[model samples]
Target: MEILPRPFDAQPLDGTSTVPKHVQLRESLRSYIVRSGEPGAAIPSERLLGEYFGVARMTVRQAVDCLVAEEVLERVVGLGTFVARAKVDLHMKMTSYTEEMIRRGMVPDARVLSFEQQGASPLVARELQIEIGQPVVRFRRQLLADGEPMSVDENFIPAHRVVGILDDPPPTSLYSVLSEKYGLVMEWGEDTIEATAASPSIARLLNVEMNAPLLKIQRHAYVARAMIDYSVSYYRADRYKLWVPLQRPGVRSPRAYSSKRLG
Candidate 1:
């Protein structure tokens, strides 16, 4: 009988006859998903995957458990198990949504809710290198997973740089276009996070209940030293937990951190 292989992202390269063949096979497939950057992407169905790998469904489930324990995949109560998108080390840098998703082992996709050029608001103008009331291109995107709402990102671009804009770029990542088409590279960023009650507008966009606490992260992104973009993000708090692991130089091995509850 065949079984799924292990999933530590470091499966043995040589044959593992001593171990279960299913474990070896699962390790190989798990490696593929990690390297392929589809961490949370929906995997092929168990029946299909079993047939393709010449394994039994039970064996496939065992392999999936290993990935889940590694935090490489997750299973929603109703939704099937998928690659998880949990980041262990939080890096403060200007990174594209797609890159961030891949790091967490989640399959990333984006939908443009709205995109157009508009006059810059006083707040936006001050953040970017532009004058108040200057032309700016604004866009709103509903970032998704296999098909679940995860976050809503809003961006404002200087109008001059946006010679043409697409209401539906239909791309997984926006920075790709900004970098490839406009020669703009995301250099650095500062983010401030807070918990807030969902306003009516936010509730509508995020499909959350009023007064529900939402994770809001405001960012000011720069290209080198110049501030070129600002974004307001509302994330489903239940879906994401931000972690920042600290390491003192010359310190001992890393230890797990547990959030403390205050009375």
Candidate 2:
């Protein structure tokens, strides 16, 4: 959670003022959140809030309770309160998994589970723009973030471009490696998202209950004239949410909502 400086122009609460000091403090904080695009953010602790607002800790607790009841913030069992990640706008162009993790201020990581040459099936061949039964580089990983297990990533790259990568698996950002080593800087990709029941593997890796609904992302990434990667990502629905923003070119844009979808 981030804390900006308290504003100086805040009108001090007087005994005769109808609004309570705690309420006024909360309102000021709420406005700061809106302007900073950090709504639902976990603010400072109750003691710190009380100190900043010149109010009692109980008064600060009252304001926090009100906000929590309204679902503006959430408290984890062991972790402190944090911004409730609720928004899921589907219309916007999808970003890379690594990119999304970085945006949320988390360090995304991956463990190479397996890497080897694989024979492409008809469907895989079509997706990678290769012939069936051709040798393709298959790279699989147990994706991680902040040292915790995330979804699994199964990706395929053309064998010719990423030679010997399967033999000498490296521990680093694949995107950065592709850009510097293979000169394959992916510019864009198309992803198809769907709701699917979690597979046994997914349930195990994501630590989710059996048969839980999960978001499946199937993507085909391209670079230069060849297909760079075809990846299938299964995100843990309970621990994850997707947020996107959409707008039309040369047109006035309307407000996008911050809520989750059933899918």
Best by TM-score: 2
What's the lDDT for all of these models?
Answer: 0.72, 0.69
Off by over 4 Å in 1: 1-93, 166-171, 247-263
- Which lDDT tens digits does candidate 2 get at residues 1-263? 54634552433446567887778766765555455535345557776666666789898777767766655656655556555554333232435557667776779887777778889989889888889998888777887777676677788877888886766655356777788777888877888888889878778887666788788888888775567889887776645666665577875544322232322
Q: What is the lDDT of residue 11 in candidate 2?
A: 39
lDDT of 1 by residue, 120-193 (tens): 99988887768999998887898876566777889888877757755545446667888887788988788899
Per-prediction TM-score: 0.58, 0.60
- Candidate RMSDs in order: 11.7, 9.6
